[model samples]
Target: MPNSDMPQTRQHCYAYPHPAVTTDVVLFTIRQRTLSVLLIQRGTPPCQGMWALPGGFLEIDEDLETCAKRELYEETGIEGVYLEQLYTFGDPQRDPRERVISVTYFALSQSDNLSPKAASDAALADWFSMNELPQLAFDHAKIIQLARTRLLSKLGYSTIAFQMLPEYFTLSQLQSVYEILLDENLDKRNFRKGILARNIIKETGEYSRLGNHRPAKTYQVVNPSQVEIIK
Candidate 1:
């Protein structure tokens, strides 16, 4: 392997500075009929002690989605949940340290048994109700607003609402999720009829007994992969 007589080529590097790229994740869950978002208290300067979405600077070798999941896990001890790319925030003055761009993602999960432990650059990790959010660091408030808009829009068409529910749930529970996100009450008869008409959910042959009242049949999404726009 000593035939290296090709003028000894050298590696090239960019001469000009460039903006840094990072990733952020917005995790949403419903607890006690209230929609909440996961937030981390920043431990470092620029916005120390301020609550923000879980995220960090992207590693050079990592993909965007990979970076997002990794940051989420690192900061909040949460992983293996469904994540979707929400949008990109590249405002030049978004970050005070330097020119930084953040590619944000949104995730949905049931908060039944999941608890967050702070790590990495996070001093604390917890869920805050959407209706009562703390002062957010960076441009996270805007990012979260956008994510909320996307979540509401997607709920009307996609089966993503199920991601925030358990595998087996009653129709009342399912309807509650829609009602919480839509922020309004839906007609029980029409809601049931519309959901059943789509043929998206099927009975699981299980019934939940609710305190001397009639039992409610449990159901699960027929095809979690199928999404339909319902009006």
Candidate 2:
């Protein structure tokens, strides 16, 4: 049904041209000990056949976040993710078709097992490692760089990284997540000490044995849905 919320519009009201609005999503997940972002091959023009973030133009009645989620699902088949608004890119020359302003969002996933089936204007979908991204369409590369910087900044004070971890994970696995995202090696003992001191996670009284190493303790976040600053 057409929404009745908008008031009646007159033909002359469209006198001034307004910029087109769009929404793009940057979804990150860990796979094969590497951090990766989801990308889709554009089936239509502007940047046909080029790999880009999953996104599209917003519908007239839909809200910003709804458009973001819809575009992401239509292009990449990824859904039910918690998205955070990152920024707005309003460069007049950003789009070839028209003066387009894009609102971008980002999300973190705990599993990389998702299978992306391309639909709508997407020809293909795949994951690209952080250290190895393909030539992206539009200003997507710039958007990703900013998202990375923001993720790194949040990792220092918030439990945002927990979204990338399983319910029951070892301290080593936790440190690995931080190291992978930060692109640096962290001291295991110190990392464990500091994280445990935050009181965000609790010992589960279970252990995991990885190869020749002895069993390591397991822990789970005290509140899975709580997004609190540990610092």
Candidate 3:
């Protein structure tokens, strides 16, 4: 006989062991005309000392995206950037320690604004060029490849590239970001024509005097929330 006001203890309904869940982040940025990714060196075992995407096990109290953001901040000291869930890796053999599943997220940020300091389970955090990445832990290399594919595909239809630029930038500066991500040089005439046709950006009537050349007119996204696919 228990008091009606007292909390009741719930009995276990099943005894099957559940797979441990984790979150990983793939942070990308453009620097010096090159696209790069943020990676951390693991300090703990099961691929200790290897470069891996910043991540950790999910906590019971957190949601998937919340866990991903928390792990990114804990490992690289980076927070408050645009993060989108990339994919899930559930291969039973992906992790050496028991059965684990990973929900990975990809983030975009301006490289000039980020200065990663390794913390938590990370021994070191640094940016690496997409073409010259070190050996990665787990299936992180596969995850990065998938992220790159997603980014390239999205560039044609979304305003995501703006995330790597400042609030106001010149057309040339914007083109460089595209060139870096696409890994190819674009014809200036055609590029400008296409961009103007799409009407995605608005001229700010401001010019950049940072370089020796004549000032270039600055522009910014007309509607940051709108997606006008590039032709």
Candidate 4:
């Protein structure tokens, strides 16, 4: 029998011009009850000093997801959040340097406490609230809007919002997250009723103490790693 493990010969397929591939990450977090996203000021040419998403040209051997994670960490010193592939943008003129296609990933992170330092083609790293974004470079603003829309659409039918909360939180905190992303105030009773009926969280028997107010009962997501579909 022929050896199944035999190495196949490699050949360079240069017959057709191929565009370079890249992976960009849109890291979102809730800050002071506002929805925010991470941005990097480019330190290199082609958009130097302009704000953009953290990303780089994909190395030939690495998968798209791995490239996204690597680019994010290298530019912003952020990692560990589960990123969902948001979209593929292959417009002929998205990048000024060359013909490049971007596979973008987005994630909700409890990353307010983590400080991001700029490096590796990034001049500075910071979070900007969705309401007040600065001038962005290389079509990054459109990418962010698409990511935000995806998150909003998933909130009603999935447990995706839990990724933005801490391990234990009050129902108010959970409701605030939804309100901030949804951009509308939710009725406390109805929101609580709808959320509790889903059975995605359970009481930790803990209480969050606020200034001069009654302690609010704290709860935890039953399975933080999986986004259970509700409907």
What C-alpha lDDT do the candidate models reach, one value each? 0.91, 0.90, 0.91, 0.91
Ranking by TM-score: 4, 3, 1, 2
Whole-model lDDT for model 4 versus the true structure?
A: 0.91
* lDDT (10s digit) by residue, model 3, range 120-153: 9899999999999999999999999999999999
Better model by TM-score: candidate 1 vs candidate 2: 1
lDDT of 2: 0.90
Give the per-residue Cα lDDT of candidate 4 at 160: 95
What value does the lDDT take at residue 130 in candidate 1? 99
Per residue, candidate 4 scores C-alpha lDDT tens digits across 72-183 of 9999998888689999999999998889999999977886546788888898999999999999999899999999999999998999999998889899989989998999
- Candidate 3 clashes between residue pairs 3 or more apart in a chain or in different chains: none
> What is the per-residue lDDT of model 2 for residues 1-231, given as tens digits with 9 covering 90 to 100?
767997877675676898999999999989888989999999999899999999999999999999999999999888977688999999999999999999999988876447778999999999899899999999999999998888889998899898898889999899999999988998878988899888999999999998899999999999888667877
What TM value does model 3 have?
0.94
